[model samples]
Target: RGMNAYERLTSYWPSYDSISPEARRAYLQWLSSGRKAPHANIGYVFLFFYGLERRVFVDAKTDQAAAGDIPIIIAEVERLLSIYGKNNSFNNYASRFVDFLRQGQILARRYQKAPPAPLPYGYEMPVELRIGLGQLAADKQPMPADWALAWVLSDHNVGKRTPVTRCKEAFAQLFCMRYEERYGAGMVLPQNKTRLRLQYNTASAGLPPQELDGLSGIPDVTATSAARKKLQQLVDECTVQLEPYSRYLGRNPDTPDALEGLLQLPVNLWPPTARTALAELKQRIGDGMVVMSFGELAGRLQSAGSLSREKVLTLARALESLHIGIEPDVLTGSRTPKSEDNVALFATQADDGDLRSSPAYSAASVTLDLACAVAAADGDTSPQEIMLLSQHIDSWSHLSGAHRKRLKAHLRLQLNQPPTLQSLKMKLEPLAEPAKRVVAAFLAHLAQVDGEVSPAEVKLLERVYKTLQLDPQSLYSDLHVASSGSSVGSSQTTPSIPGASPSKPVGGFALDQERIAQLQRETEQVSALLAQVFVDDKPAEPDDVVVEETVEDTSSICGLDADHSAFLRVLVSRTEWSHDELEAVASDMELMLDGALEQINDMAFEHFDMPVTEGEDPFEVNPDIMDKLPL
Candidate 1:
């Protein structure tokens, strides 16, 4: 469609408001699309024009336009305000319109001119009227009857007014009128005994003059005999609807009985509607009953079978508006305050650190257990060990006092039944590879916690290395660099063992003379045995024997256990080992394998019919038998 006249005018002037009748009609038709505008800016434009319409009404009232323009302005203002009343931004503009109209009435009264007739009631009139009349009554002026009746008829006032107040004014007016028609006006009670008299007296003290004016001429009655049951039912329903707010109001002391006090607070700082609803409730239910009802509702909502998400959210929001702190878990139906404290007892390190789901709690638990095991391995748990463990526990700030105590106690118990290497490895196996490396590093740290690593601690660390399938050489190097007070992973020389003089370097590592000599003697012995076995044999290819079979056969021949045999096999298979190093391992096993090698040598010589000669070797075996042998 082509651009409307209003759209064209706005495009050029931006703030243009003085449009012709046709343009104004086009604008109104455009706004009638509600939220379906082609662009969001159109909605803003609609609000602007709507505001201008309200300004027109103000001008008409100012001029005291009695007939033609006044009615038209009122109808247009009502239509615009009703369409956008729920919008906070629109309400802000409408409030100004209401203020202007109220000010005009005050000026008319001041000049002794007759006040204009009250504006006709429309859908958005009640809240706007209530606010306007409230301000007028605050100045001690009597509010008009038509204005107050319009407020009472507005069903949107449910949470804004107390059941008792509503019953007296709105319900009483309806019931009294009915009764007067059925039983005649003379049958009505004396003025002082009538419900209307009581309501007017109470309202006159608290309500604006406009609200009181609306109650002026209703027939007074002491009781509505036939309508009592229905009136009571309406009162009960209103009380039930107001129950949540009433309870909230009774809990605070600053503004106990009045809902208006809450409404007067800054809109951004408080839940205005909720607090007002609560205050209205407190007025009808009395302080004690409201408090009791709130407790009952809270209890029911907390229970498993009775809990409702909607009710819980409403109650929580209400309490929050009052600045009352509530645990979110309670609203989520997860745990009560007491239960939450109890749950802290079993919290893992991740739980204590406020890391809800990143690190697995099970992994943390296993890590803790391994640390305790390492600490206990040294016969006695020292103060340094305890302090280190305490430091680790302290990092988990989410742990409760009871939880920390229990963990410490469990660590003490673990010292009595210290976990075996295999058991510790089982725990560590489930951890990720990085976690395993970290655990290994921590164990190394624990061993050197007392300034020096004891032989037993070093031995235990070696066992851990084997059990966890970690590199012992790398771990040893790391621990040594750490103990030497050098930067880790740096190319620093290895520090000499405590009380041992620095000796000659073997493959760049310094070794004690005595240890070097022992190694040399073992190497010689291993080479001599290998010479006897392979002396008369054809050179066997490295690929002739399977490494797996060689390892198993070597274990059986040397009478060693499977684990030790595997260890030895791994050392032999490593390409990094020097010839002397390989000889040393073979030499270490020579004593146990002596008889087995001798029997094999004898059988091979017999089967081959090879005779011993003076110049030839007597211990030489057949090449085939030597090839099949694992030695």
Candidate 2:
């Protein structure tokens, strides 16, 4: 419809008295002769639209061209302006005007060659447009027509508040081009970055011009106070809704890097809030610190309420990369050691001065928990995997004084091997059962983030359960018991109800006779057994306290049907101990590591001992023990 109107105005406007003779003749001849209707009039209209629409509509009588005739009038204006400069005026003003026309023509031609694809009706302009125009306007000389058009669009008087939107978009396209130039067409932003970009573009909105300036000029002190308040409020909100995903992925490693990468790409391209956070974080981490632990930074990002969840994760990734390691000389004023362990320790030292409570520990714990939570959400319980995850926890924890020195020395060693169960058990197995449970609980908490359990996670849980001598199945089943109990207790503690009969239970009987009796009879027995097996003797055998449903022979017993994968994932991610280290851990509680090893070996041996009389897929056989096996 707009195009149709424009065409009608372009074809009819030659008859108007405001048009020049030369332009009128050109238009009439083009129209009467009908030589494909030369687009010169259309071009004129475009220029006029660009100029007149840029200013305020001060009055109805103002020289604002009708919307339909804007383009044609602009082209006519350009042509006449050129003529006036070349023939009528010769003084300094004329010279300057000539220069302006030339520039405007170049910009217009460039625009014509590729006028920005028309923006959606309510779309904001990209950042590139603003910065590009700003750069162009920086010149002392008068701007050309196109540059002037850009300048006017960016001007404070332009009623629209989103000039930056255009600038942002423009900058993004420009950055994309620049990125492609450096990294090649096939290279793409990291997944986190891509996700964040999509999210930022979608959720972001522009303010009115006045509001925008207000936000932009938000004083640091004011911004800081607001950010801190927001952060506190958000943290409180998170306390209740903090599901496994929120706990694990809240300050996830994957998020913050994507955001940081975007911020680092170009300052002028980022949103004001994003720019401010990035700038502050950069200052905190130091300009040279590109690669960092997302978990570490996020922990220190106490004033992170200003950041979106996605942005927080993006920043995490940026800090985790080795390429962005902090410069030792700048931070701690020292170079690192040569050994892998030493290097790791040195890296910690280089981060900050404090050892017991450095930002590095905060980062490591958060990221590790996030990783574990992500794994557990999958819900595959396997012991072997848990053992592997434990090693990471052990390796990461206890980074004070001598421990810190030990880790730095080992930092130089290759960490390329995929974490394994034997390795985790090796380091974590030596810790006392209570200590192991603490570490295991930490891992479990992390795994619970996603609300599912993996085979590796099961293994970690099994090790902890066995060491503590608690029933793994019962524990898993009652996993939500802790949270549920807390909720109920809170409700029961309330003194009164808003609109209830006084005689009836206000908040459902402050837990007196019936409920206590039922719980005592049902749960007490199990709890006592658990206390005997886990808390007292710390017995390793399932048969000692765990009730068997079937089977009689104690020696030729079938293996415990519990999953161990969860334990394994947690174990491996936490530490890096050797097999002997694990064996020692089992030994502390009188659980013979050698016996467990033998059982695992026997389980493997039992698999191949079966007869295959008929032709079949050998691998199709199930490895579980048969129901009526010889005892």
Candidate 3:
């Protein structure tokens, strides 16, 4: 029977491991002479050979032994293909050879394990082959010197070993070929040991090494050790140069553990050009060209506002290293300053006389002063009071943790020397108009923090209102207090100035002399009645006659005469009396008077020849009221 395709292929190509050396040599000779074979069968032979070569190349210990043989195989294949002309058979073999070389170059780079021996002598290489090997070595995947030497020795009947000097020369030639391929062809190889050492050291460092023109002789053991030490010294110098930058950046360079932690951080955590910029900044600061503290510099960086205690301590160390003076109380080595000294320092810093020029600073200072004053207004500072004050400050300002801590310290110091009302007012006077309003509202809020505004707190708030030059009614309105009268048990009120009107006109009506006197009497009566109401749990109801008299008195005080007063009295008598019954009756009477006033206004407008719309009735005509009129 005829052989099948698999059998035919296997017959022509025995397993590579099973092939005898003589048979392989004879086959290569015939292939080089252009003897045609089945293209598929020849391809299978080349593939099997490449697989065997791959195994030998990948084994580190034996790879150097086989490296010398690769070039011979490549050269023989090239000779065969040149004679055979272009065809699938030659193409397949050529492709496999190229693939093998590529993989070997990659393995050389990945391992970076060059053999101790160099290339052997007396093997002439084609310019194309030299250029290919040069390109591979220059691609950062250095071709192993011993590997190239072995390849050069492949076709020759040389001994197992070669002279190291001759090998070095061959390796140098290969490297030069690569260098010429990369740069232009006319450049000479660099022969200076100093330049080579520089390139080597620079490559060992983080930066890309400049290409050296030529290889100097390899150094002996003592020379190599010395070179390594010099390289390490350069590295140390670089680290020392970075010390100022890290210190000014709030990183502790002295602490090895801290530096190691910094190294492990992500790239973006340390911004680009930050070290250089900070170094320049430090130089500027040292020269007195820029005046700023380390803390202020760190405050401008990202994630610096929320620094941890450890980081804060590290920042202190860094600042010390830079010789940038920090306030003794602001930060010291790992621990916070002593409480008393810290408080004193904070108070002094915050209360500097120059704060008057800065509205925000003055406002903060006055706020702390007022808080201390209010806290002690009722004789002592309670924990609840301190807590309430803290919350108020937090809500009012966007203060960092360090600033807040300093403020707390200042507050404690202020409690020792609470300012008088006049002093506090003077301090607060520099605040802007909007800030003054905020302070007024804050004081009012603070007064009611204990769930009830105390008499002392009310008195303090009143003083503040006047001191701040704010309207008392507006202050009370902001506090949501009842505007009709002062709060119970408190003496706060809109006090009348000496030359000012005794009574502010209500509803745009001027009070005559009698009406003014009557209004004063009624105000006193209301105050007395309110005091009574608060004293008794349930106030006793006044008799009808007394209620009628009170209603008539209030009406006349409000500028209404006898007829209108009688109408109000009738309205009050019809409603059941309560503690605030007088107030309710007064409200109703005011509404009725408003309508009557409107009718009078319309009639006056008509008299003045102003047209009035037909459907618009300014007043409701009450027949019962009209009939009761004296006219």
Candidate 4:
């Protein structure tokens, strides 16, 4: 029993003095094996955790190991949690330990010191993640995916008492889509070199002896007085933007006005000198400046004659930090190619942009939507392919830069959002004749770009063909009549799809002269129409409405049985409850505590589409059903 680790454990807390002698031997044996067991006694793990906590908050900080040892500490903590995380006591402490590490990173940033490390995506809760990623202040417009991601990761009630978490996989899909689109093309990326910080108060704090409970390796409440989250005014202002995306913590979300609510604006913390710029930017945003082309942005910033180029860029960054995205791409130039215009610099500010107001733009935007549908038709194309598809959209420079912005946004939304027949129906039904032919030919071209037409592509194309009244049978021979009619190199839009590197028909169709001519002609017609019809011919009544459907709460909520349902209602009312309180309630309802809990959680996974309710002793409800409750 007198071993190295047992002695270390006692140094963390005197409570370890009562650990059983048998447990003591197990703990030492576990430590001697490098503490690498996949499973171990919860008590033994806690004893080890006591030492880890000391290393992080006490030893690491006090000994200046916070410089580099924190990463090793985090890795060890994560490894321990991977094994014992199911234990409520262990999971809660470990999860909070990681979160507090994140807090330290944020605090370190504020103190102008280096953060130990960046928290990787999915490493912590969504609330903390959003703040860390600078999403909180990002006056991000509520795109359908954003709303859907928020709704699905949240909790909701199916019936009177049946509460469940919404789909997490859906949230992950949307998150990855957004991340790749913003950061680069891929499922995940390494952390950016942005600064991070966190602080702790030690002067006014009193230290606990080893006899006291094992300290949680967190800073004192005084240091965290503002709760780590209260940084950046704009972040606090647009609370609806990112805060609700908190990762499911087995607890239900706090209730607000489930049925209704009001938005509270963040205070303007910008210094007085740039007040003119802020006012100008606000005015432009209010006046439908949704797609602030680099050209337009330079002119507007220059209107502030007092502000130099550096001052203008600083002002833009300041606005972006507040979540008001404006001209992020254009740095020093007033003139940029139409290709550069597609950046939705003001996407965080405006909901319905004037870009869609133009009949020509709206008519053209639908083309990109269907293109994305075609690209994803097989449901196996990589995001990079879809992005390459955006480059194809980019070649349609005939459409103004503003139009491209809206078009690309549509493509991104379609790629991640749940597909809807109604949106396609609405868009296709209203198209004029020229628009219809161009739309049909565009899909035909995109579908066969891989040389061999996929069944999924053919199937999606058939639907599109029928919708536009293009003859599905004539899909092959109409355009490719003669070899001279090939249009492969005739226009910029014919740039080969990523997989189809060559300009001509690729696979089996590559050698067939008739098929090659057809692909060329198909490319020509599609490009010509895109250049002419998309900009020249405007529909009499263009459907300028953005294609997004409001998903009903009923669609997402998973229902539980009468007993479990009733139990859920009780659980959602409060975040934390003692085991005795939970048991007393279960007994009053004539239900077995363990079975009802398990059954309800099963429904949480099955219907709510997430695994909730991890640990107990102090249950923190995070389901969205609690969203209806006043916070």
Off by over 4 Å in 2: 1-11, 14-311, 321-467, 470-631
- Return the TM-score for each candidate structure: 0.24, 0.21, 0.25, 0.27
- Candidate 1's C-alpha lDDT? 0.38
| lDDT over C-alpha atoms for residue 33 of model 3 | 43
Q: Give Cα-based local distance difference scores for all models.
A: 0.38, 0.31, 0.38, 0.44
Deviating ranges (above 4 Å) for candidate 1: 1-370, 377-381, 389-439, 452-467, 471-482, 486-631
Better by lDDT, candidate 4 or 3: 4
Give the per-residue lDDT digits (tens) of candidate 4, residues 1-631: 3444333333222345676665577687888888866655565776777676667667765677564687787788888777767665456556556555544433311212211232222212222333322222122222233322332232121111111223233223434454345434211211222211221211111233221122223221111112121211222232223233222211334422111100111113222433466566666665233554445554443332233344444444455554454432223232122423433444343433323334445444555566667767787765445645666556555566655654565565456542454466754665566666655655665555544456776677667777677666544432231222443222232222222323443342234445444544444455444444345434342222322322333312255543455456555434455687667656655578788788867776665565445578876555433322211
lDDT, residue 414, candidate 3: 61
Q: Give the count of colliding residue pairs in each prediction.
A: 9, 141, 5, 29
> How does candidate 4 score on lDDT?
0.44
Q: What is the per-residue lDDT of model 2 for residues 245-341, given as tens digits with 9 covering 90 to 100?
A: 2223333536532343343333344445555665565565443223333344443433333444344333323433312232221122222221121
**How do all the candidates rank in terms of TM-score, highest first?**
4, 3, 1, 2
**Candidate 3 per-residue C-alpha lDDT over 66-182 given as tens digits, one digit per residue, 9 for 90 to 100:** 666666666655554554324443343343343334334222222234332212211222212333333333343443433343333331111121111222332234333443354
Model 4: per-residue Cα lDDT at residue 312: 43
Top candidate (TM-score): 4
lDDT of 1 by residue, 392-481 (tens): 554444445434443454444454456577765644554444444545655564455445566666667777777777776656764665
* lDDT-sorted candidate list, best first: 4, 1, 3, 2
